[model samples]
Target: MAQWNPSEEYIENTRLYKWMQKLGYSEYDLFHQQSINDVEWFWRRVEKELGIPWLNHYDRVLDVEKGIQWPKWYVNGKLNAYELALGQWAKDPIMTQKEALIWEGEDGEVRRYTFSSLATEVNKVAAGLKKLDVKRGDVVALYMPMIPETIMALMAVSKIGAIFTPVFSGYGQEAIATRIAASRAKLVITVDSSQRKGKEIMLKDELDKALLNCPEVESVVVVRRTKTKAVQLKEKHIAWEELLSHQPCLEIEPMNSDEPLMLLYTSGTTGKPKGTVHTHSGFPIKAGFDAGICMDLKRQDTLFWYTDMGWMMGPFLVYGGWVNGATIMLYEGSPDFPNADRLWQLIDRYHISHLGISPTLIRSLMRHGDNWLTQKLSSLRVIASTGEPWNDDAWYWLFEKVGKEKIPIFNYTGGTEIAGGILGNVLVRPIKVSMFNAALPGMSAYVADCWGNQMENQVGELVLTKPWVGMTNGFWEQPKRYLKTYWSRWPNMWIHGDWAITDEDGYWKITGRSDDIINVAGKRVGPSEVETILASHHYVHEAGAIGIPDHRKGDALICFAVLQESIEMTNTVKETLLDFLSVKLGKSLRPNDIHFISDLPKTKNGKVMRRLIKNAYLHLKLGDISSIENPNVLDEIAQLKRPGQKNL
Candidate 1:
């Protein structure tokens, strides 16, 4: 890792130093110290400084006696998140006519919408929802792609005090049906189809299949994206254009600041997904603040984040960028579409200031070499990464190629539950390879062992000791499950299930998941699910699955199976296993490779030694093997390797 001396010029010109000085902070004081000592004062100051509108003010800013389970924020305030994001800005001359959304398709088509224009569309949509008998607190499902209409639908749902659930367009019909049924959504917003990598996907067809299972869905609004001929609408189905054409653009509705605004589902390993609830005031405020300071986004910046509406990053990008009055560049296509340089071309042509990506995408680009990045992106200022832990190779390549060793790569790590990042790199900090410089202000995070003991410079589970404003209120309709998953592990602390270790220099590195979970290409999966599918095969007796660290994907799934005595393992068998698993567990969950073993290592209690298998495959140092009853099984498996094998 290369370290550069702090430049006085950079320090003076940085966004953090300038904001701190403007906000009446002394130059010698640290941000974290000031924020911790006056937590309420800090948030109250942010609410006022950011010009957030409130219909009524609260007597108290924060009440902590509830132990994060019941954080009484803005005790008496009345305001709607929609009013703050669009209405308040609609009244201001500085932002009314400014371009709020810039939509670019893979086929080189583009569309632009101003704040006033978007507000009109949102108002009409809100009116249409009301006409359809949708009431406050009703759940609305958004099954659209990454387009401007998606943002309008979200704002419309919030305007009417209805909670919105945005599902990813890439999901299959079964996945979509499960979420819609769980949410009990009354209305669904979708498009006819979307183009990805020059191929058309029938989004409306999938929505129809999902709606068949969701009888509660009374109305369906379709947005026409492609010129696919004609389909007669059902009794409850309506064209989006028809709804907006007759309705009048009206004023924004005001509600309590703490009112529920959206429900986003977290991909759980077992059982159904948990619906995480977020409020309007806290989410946008926190997202905007973090975007401005941590990401160093400015008014003149053009920001781009590659994500789907189903993911939290989708809403985060909109709220964070638009609140700062920055131009948000969006694309509804694959990064490698048309050619490998498609993303680079957009950055070059649009002169994007801040570019956000995932480590998996960067590694794929690195394999093609850095020729696309040879051209100087003079307007580029910051590069951000999230979704999964970054590797040393990808981090170094970003700094060298995309940044030309000039711009800093801000690494952010957080979840959908919290609207903002807990740990992020700041502009003032020195850039180290694949590590967060420090935890965000007003957040207290530390690594703890299994017994709830805090440890330094050792691998442990990441836990949060205090509650932050951006934390989710609770899981919708599953408060007990939420408590069991997060707070039950440690009292009043959030156990994030991630294995992390902090160095003496205060840089945090993520090792892997504490639970037996797998992250393949930034998608979360459970080992048990894959193992269950493998065991169903006729030739497989028993199987164990584990994730191995890979440079391309953050991790790759590796399966070890003890075949039945009647079957003989061969190339044909390997091919058959691959095909079966791909169909059963989806392509993303398919194992990278399969290994055949005669006997599985187990303890006297009959617990399989999954750790030993992972260690042997990666050639890493075995941590503890005394618990294994037959450790010799590992040696036998290691010796029965095929030709050209370097390590087991």
Candidate 2:
């Protein structure tokens, strides 16, 4: 057992503890003791305490005879997420006219919608969808930017009990077509164009190209955004406003809790995206619970998360904030556009209370220095990070600059499958370097090695031992793939393919993906290990390392590095880095070669695309190059390849 106890000072000073006290818990000891000793009772109490409205009650709270295979939760219960998010709130006199969504575009355009107004818009869209012949279980593909209409469309689809599959606006036509076709979508909602970095992108044209390959799509609804010349509408194409002009704003169809709500795809090692299906009750409830208790969100709080509708974070952010009656802030542009301080300016202007971002963005801000971030972030109460593992330097910089080293940086980790974070850092926990203080309540997580044996203080695969409410039902149209990917490796555990370790302090640290682990001379070395070491170098701005097939060493560590402006790539510098690595991690773990480049390949959200780097090195045909932010970086790295060397 771990003797991990939070400091009294930290608990008393934290926003989470104060909220718990306001909720009637005088101390963390009482709350934790009650939570652990009676988990079912605690969850039941939470369901009631959080004011979750249910039309039908359950006979039993939990049924475990089926194990993870078919564990029934809230048996005999009937509650729809749509009702909990909009219906009850809309009925309440105090919350009816309150602002629920606040949206801002890249071109200084702003829009606000109240709870009642949002419900009206959602009902109109829902009626429009019904007129277009959409029915329960029918898939609706959303290929739009982060706009208010997108949120309305999501709620409209869920209200009518249809499954929504959102494709990122940054994705190319081919990627979009693949997802739409795979889901056999009956309709697609998009816009003529979208603004990003002060430029208008032709989104409808891209959708046109994608729809050519997706014949199952019966109709397309286009929203006017950039005031660009409209495309020639086909028999199936209709303007968004025209479609909903005469629709009523009071129609809503409730759904069962276990019905599919959304399908989010996760790119696998082979580049084939797996569609993860989340149920209505499983995801929305979990997201709201975590946002309310863990984030300590309030009605007056404004939550801003820089994300697209395609990512799981988008839905998580929407449900989490809306269910808590907090205002949701949506930004439709690049984070670094116009200036490096754009995000900061928005926070200051909007009085945002909670800010969620990735570590890569923070590191980029760190590269630009702290002059902009040093401004008064008085409205900011907490900072949250996800998507990729954060380095110590970035973590410290974020806590120092944005949070003043006093606020909690909730380092959370889960995936599209779980819908929300399985492990997270509560506000009362001590801040550490890239560590998750604890798993979410009712979740049981463990670290195990390759032999299925539990490990401690050693890196291993992260697994969930018990089934939770937020767990995905299965993959969309591919139940076998779901079983093979997560459940086949372990009898009853869900093995998330990531490398993690727990410290003696009971804090968990994630390295990189287990599939990305390098085998050098029969020894295992995670890419994060070498990348972390390389990031420690002052001259190295960013680095991504991968293992390539080597005739002599079996698999050798090949590193690609980006340099700072004042740093130059020279033979001496490379040797110095090699020597530094030798001194720090021993010569055996030293990188075989380090190639300096202008930038590392990344996704739009700033996650390093290491698979692309490995593919470039081996001269392999790059799959789904559409998701890369800088596809040219691969060609630039390819130019440095030696003659007759294998191309990744």
Candidate 3:
């Protein structure tokens, strides 16, 4: 069969086609190389193409005086993110009246919003923040569910030039307080309670507890969402309704493009979480550019990404979709709620052109069977994936069952620090199962060996050679730490901690985190490399591979696998599994132990907590596990020790 390329709908009608004409480049490789080789001209054209306004034009596109560690973008340009995202579409009658926000709850509640109405609500929150003294450089935090108001609060905070950070709704007090205090945010937005999977999660109650430790928090804005009894309002607590009852300011503040916009705290291997800072021009512009070119999103499209407000995808979806003038769908509960068809229903109802989700979600749904995925989804032109690398079984299931093998899996990889993707599948190319077509146009990413030499076939570290828009300013108040984290590994290159490989066919695959590369015996292998081999088995749903110290071979591998439902692990079955893995990975690298479990520990964003597994196996202190979604599973894993193992 012939390979599929960018659809006619994209090449014929999208703004990318218009830009291709303007740049006089019909081929993607030529455009990609030019975008990197001439950074200044490329970004200037991109900003203009996106119709982003610059009250004061940039003196230059990039400034490297501070070196790549802190290269300034769009220097001297002044613009509002709200203005950038809204652009000329805010004035269009059809766009203003078009349904821009779609929301549904686990309890059968649904809400839709026109762009004008959404803007009004966002302005009301902005006005309220202004009234509460949330000034231009002040930080406001949101610990809320994936509700329309959650996104509105984010937009409103950006509208007034206040840096906003979001804590996951399911987080405990300690996790919430840690981020709120670290960012020193004065105002917080949250719901009194929220419903998820038919259960009530007390959001405002947890916020109040978190605030007790966060002396920086001066006030709270509460959304009354659940049917739980209303509690008495405290001195610092105010209702969302009360804030919106007042007249909205209806004005956006234009700030310098380089001004801070958000402070998201991501966990590190070291003890504490680092607060990553993103700027006004950086995150929004990069996100929009990725959505426009990679996802081929147009204003006529509707985007629905299964995510929580806490994850980067939440902000990525909102900023990326709107910044490109596409309608966005936000669901507030479990991806699998009353039934497994919930996600498909959203796609069907909203006519989602771009559907973003994680490979873990697909793996989880794959176990539930594809009976619910029977709905017609011709509108889904792109199946966007991130959070983690894909296993063959889950990748094939998603492509065949969900996308009907027609849509491309737009594999993307970057991090909160980048504010957008580094490597991603572009619309111009044909994706090979689970691979990135190329690095996003502007990023100069490459796979290199430990000594900084570029590698071929063999897996190596992923490095970005040139700085791009949306690279975080730095860890909040920790510039030295930021340099040591990303730039210290290599002289000038940004060592992005992830492991990757490029095949002879020019396809790229992010194997796993560089730090996560398990050195068993003498061969270094990424966890995903082994996990993928195991997950390909008919009985294995998902697998977590960890390296434990082996006095015999320097280090040995262990795999904790979540088997398919109703599958029993007999001795014969175990032997068969071990032999199968040996054939795929060779006897020298085959895992010493394979334990079956009900679930694997993961964060809300769906990344496996591999370190937790290693720590548990090594009998080391299990550090801050506040981000773990399923902590109980860790206890189950801790009980499974190899032969002759004592402490475990």
Q: Over the full model, what C-alpha lDDT does candidate 3 score relative to the true structure?
A: 0.80
> Backbone clash tally for model 2?
8
Give the TM-score (vs. native) of candidate 1. 0.88
Misplaced by over 4 Å in model 1 are: 1-6, 22-29, 229-235, 526-546, 558-648
TM-score of each candidate structure, all chains considered together? 0.88, 0.78, 0.81
Write candidate 3's Cα lDDT for 92-153 as tens digits. Answer: 78788877788988887899887888888888888888888889999989898888888888
Per-candidate Cα lDDT values, in order, are 0.79, 0.78, 0.80
The candidates, ranked best first by TM-score, are 1, 3, 2
Candidate with top lDDT is 3
Query: Candidate 1's residue-wise lDDT over 1-648, tens digit each?
Result: 434334778866776767677767635237766776777877887777567778777788888776776576777787778776777676778878877778889998888877888888889888887887778899999998898889888988888888899987876565677778889899998998988878888888878876788998988998888866465577889898877875764755666767788888765655566788888777887887778766778874788888888888888887788667677878898887888888888888778898889899999988888776656688888888887898787888888777878888888888788887888887776778889887876777889998888898999999988777778888889888888888897777889888899998888877778766677877665666567668879999998888877778888888888899998989799789877776555455667888888777887799877777777665668777888888877876555543235674
* lDDT of each residue in 1-648, candidate 2, tens digit only: 221234687567554577568667875546755664565676676666567777687777667785674556677777777777777787789999988888989888899998898888888888888888899899999999999999989888888888999987776665677678888999999998888778888878878877898999999998888886766677888898976775664655656666788898765543346788887767888788788778777776999988878878889888888778888999999777788888998898889999988776677677778776645878987788877677777787787667776667888888788888878887666657678887766666779988778889999999877766767878888877888888888798888888899888778888766777565543344577567667778988898888876533445778878888898889998888776655444444577888889998999989888888888867787889887889999998767764236788
Candidate 3: residue 32 Cα off by (Å): 1.5
**Candidate 3 segments whose C-alpha is farther than 4 A from its true place:** 1-18, 516-648
Locate the minimum summed-lDDT window of 10 residues in model 2.
Answer: 1-10
- Model 2 — TM-score against the truth? 0.78
Residue pairs clashing in model 2 are: 615-648, 616-648, 617-648, 618-647, 618-648, 619-647, 619-648, 620-648
Worst 10 residues of 1 by lDDT: 637-646
